[model samples]
Target: MFAQIRWRLLLSYLTVFTSILVIFAAGVRLLFARSLTQQLTDRLTALGQGAATNAEFDNGRLKVESDFIVQQLIHKNQGLEWFNLNQKSILKQGNIGLNLPLSLSKSPIQFSNKNFNIQAVVVPIISNDNGKIIGYIRVSQSLEEVDETLTKLDLILGSSIIIALIFSGFSGVILTRQAMQPIEESFQRLKQFTADASHELRSPLMAIKSNAAVALKYPEKMRKSDVEKFQAIVSAANQMTHLTEDLLLLARSEKKCDRRENSVNLTAILSNLLSLYQPEATAKEIDLKSETGEDMYLLGNAGQLTRLFANLIENALHYTLSGGTVEVTANLVRSYLIVSVQDTGAGIAPEHIKLVFERFWRADESRSYWKGGSGLGLAIAKTIAQNHGGSITLTSQVGVGSCFTVRLPSVKISDNSQD
Candidate 1:
């Protein structure tokens, strides 16, 4: 149980942490990539536009206004080239070795050469006097530095994520363990109190019954009032003893040693339960029936499984009115052995149905407690079923009766090694 709790706690924390980290990392990387590309494009576009503006058509020949384009290319590591409308280069700098076709495209275009990976924009040169095309200017910027920076940023994010996960795994497990300490301590205290209280009550209860029995031996010499008093004390002590035993059983149900198991034939068990309750059913004028199959076997502790079914049948017969019907059925369904105890009696209301298996929870929605129940029978049955790797479920309507179904993993004939 603690192992399961620990893993669940760690996984839950890591799920949220990893998701946030992944989203934040991706978001930051995306923003950085966009900003880098935009700044580079903007710088290349401004230089291309300035070069285009410096050209002029002088007496039917295109000519630059000054050495402005050459000055901008020096020491900047940016490629600058001028092209006539005939797609021929006029001025080339920064040792650009490619003779690409002329393009009047405003967007940045990327190309690679031996010296640099370049992003260039082609700005159109228009004659202000005639509003016609004259020539073009191409400005290119090197992307080596930008690529190196982004590569370093990616490596840092990847390394950080790996380290964070490793450290968080260990720390998350330890922190979760510390968080569960209070619950573990409270559970231990509850079990201790139950065991100690039952032990304490049993001793005094035995003494009271022993003294009462001694007094009862002299009933002939005593008045009616004294006999009644002793009888009451003995009866009360017996009741208290039974209650204490039940409490002890509930407390120890989860112990590993108490769950020592063997193959048990549920068919025989159900038959035995039916036979045991037959007389009570007959006296109450109720119809008790069993439709159990033979050799319906399962692996479980015999005593606990017996108690599980016994409690269900007992409750069914207890709440059943005279002339009502109580049925116990056992059958094998696929890999599971199913046992159901159904009664035609006062049923549970919808509001209280979910609380049937809760400890000490009795349904008082429409019924009274005249049919004396300890209210722990179903709770004990539920625990025993779970300990045996089984489950118990219920189906009931308020006016109609309730059915409690238990499913246990069936023992197959192929597993006859236990025989």
Candidate 2:
């Protein structure tokens, strides 16, 4: 149970951490790509404008006069090329014609080929007077740099997720162990108490039973009052026997040492349990009913399930008054098998509702002696549900009634059924 809780905590942490990291990584990648693309485009546009402005039409040839400007443009823009309108490259260096368009068009043209990590943008240099096409200035840049940056970002994000998962997993295990330590210690103490209490009660109970038997054997010599006293002793001893049995059951439940898997027909089990409890309900004049779905099978310990339901039903019967109703329903809903026990009894108080499931907790202190309850019923039920990868919850109103619902994952009928 502690391990399960810890795993759930770890998974929750992982989900949240992965979600945030993925969103952040995507955002960063998008911004970086956009910024880089825009910077490249702006630089290309500026160079194209410069080339147009610096063009000088002398006779029939266009001449670029500024040596400093040409050197700056070529050196700074390493991967860009300048080309003429006749599909001829002017700059012979740095892979030129890759950007120059095949068709003569005035509009800016952009193209990319991811195989080579190459991107190209071409713009025509138009004459200012007649708006006629003069020459073309093409700009191209390698996407290798961008790819490298993104790869690094991926590595960083991946490493962070792995590190966080490791740390959280370790922390979750430690925290879970610490949290369960007190509970384990409490259970140990409870076990010792049960053993001691049982041993202490046994001697007195045996003595009483033995004396009662001796008196019965010599009934002729005993007075009527003495017989009556012996009968009372026998009755008390019987009650003590029942109490000891309940205590042992509770102790075994607390230990939770048994874990065997077996296929069990849940519907059949519920039906049988309802049948067994019917007589008790009739004695109290409380209506006990069972509604089970068809062929609801699951893999679990039948003994544990029986104990779980017995505790719940017994508690319900104990609390409920005559003419009240107790209902048990089982059904398969989606992937879960749900079992609900509802009772129209002296409903739990709002304040005591939460504490009712705790060990040795009783809402009605006045009826504690009459009920003959050790107050470990609901706790045992809860433990059983959890052991089966299930959960139990309660809802109650003071004047109305209380409902205890248990939901467990459905299992196949063909699976191992040793439990």
Candidate 3:
């Protein structure tokens, strides 16, 4: 249980760490991208403004000075295009094309082609004499280098996040284990106390029950009221004894231990249990029967296995209505033996299914009390199945019946060998 808790804690830590790292990386990437884009846009706007300075209207036609174009060609990736006020291209310089359209808007407008993305700004040339629009200058640059730099930044951030997560995963395991140590110690101490207390109470409980039984054996010597009092004492002691025994079993089962024992035949065990329960079924007028294969064997303690199935059977019989069916079936599938106890009973609600195996959890509380159930039967059965490297599952509906299936790893034996 502590191991399971540690794993869950470590997973939660890693999940939260990964989320924060991803968000931080994304924020860094977004800010860096925006800063680089802003720098490109500013450079384009400045170049377009400078080109607009050298513009002049000659004979109502726009023209740009040759000196400005020559000086601006030093920039390798930069491009420029000039257009007359009529929106016709006047000149193309550097790497820009004449096919580029004129833009009256002062802000940068982005364009993309098969080769690369372009960031451009348009500057409208106003006549110095009359302040009338004369021409337009478009300055642009390719975004290849900026894209390459950002790609490299992405790679670096991604690799860093992965490495950090790998390291954090290792540390998370250690941290979660350290964190759970106190809780684990406390749980172990509680189990020890329960085992010790249950063991200590057994003798006194049995003695009280025995003394009450002996006193009741000679009922004529006592008044009728005293006889009733002794009978009540015997019943109370028996209940306490059963409760203590269950508590002790649960406490012991919680301790990790190897459970492999002698080979046990499941078929014979179920047969015996069926015979034992047959009289109760007859009295209740319920149909209790077994449909099982022969010589189904598993490596486990015979007593524990018997107790596991007995609990299931008793639980089924207790809930089932008179004339309802309780069927115990066993079948071999692959290397596992599947045994199921199905009952046509007052089926458990869907919400209560998960709580069925919890210690002292009863679906029908008042009915279980009247039926003398301590509410630990299913829990004990689950513990025993888990100890033997098996699992038990339940399937039920409210109006239909319920099935409790136990799947255990089966063993094969030769004819000459004795179990």
Clashing pairs in 2: 261-419, 262-417, 262-418, 263-417
Instruction: Please provide, for model 3 over 1-419, each residue's C-alpha lDDT reduced to its tens digit, 9 standing for 90 to 100.
Output: 57778898899999999999999999999999999999988888777777788889888688678566444563657878888878888788887553656777767787896798878888888888899889888877888889999999999999999999999999999899889999988988988998999999999998999899999999999999999999999989988999999889888776544545478889999999999999999999999988996888888778788989999999899888898999999999999999999998878888989999998887773235245877788898998898888999999888677999999988876522335
Q: Kindly list the per-residue Cα lDDT of model 1 for residues 132-195, writing each as its tens digit.
A: 8788878777787787888998998888887898899999988999999888889889888998
* Per-model TM values vs. the true structure: 0.64, 0.54, 0.89
- The prediction achieving the highest TM-score against the true structure is 3
Question: Per-model C-alpha lDDT, please?
Answer: 0.82, 0.73, 0.85
Clashes of 1: 0
Of the candidates numbered 1 and 3, which has the greater lDDT value?
Answer: 3
TM-score of 1: 0.64
Query: How close is each model in CA RMSD to the real structure?
Result: 7.7, 10.1, 2.9
Judge candidate 3 at residue 229 and give its lDDT. 100
Instruction: Write out the backbone clash pairs for model 3.
Output: none
Top lDDT hit: 3
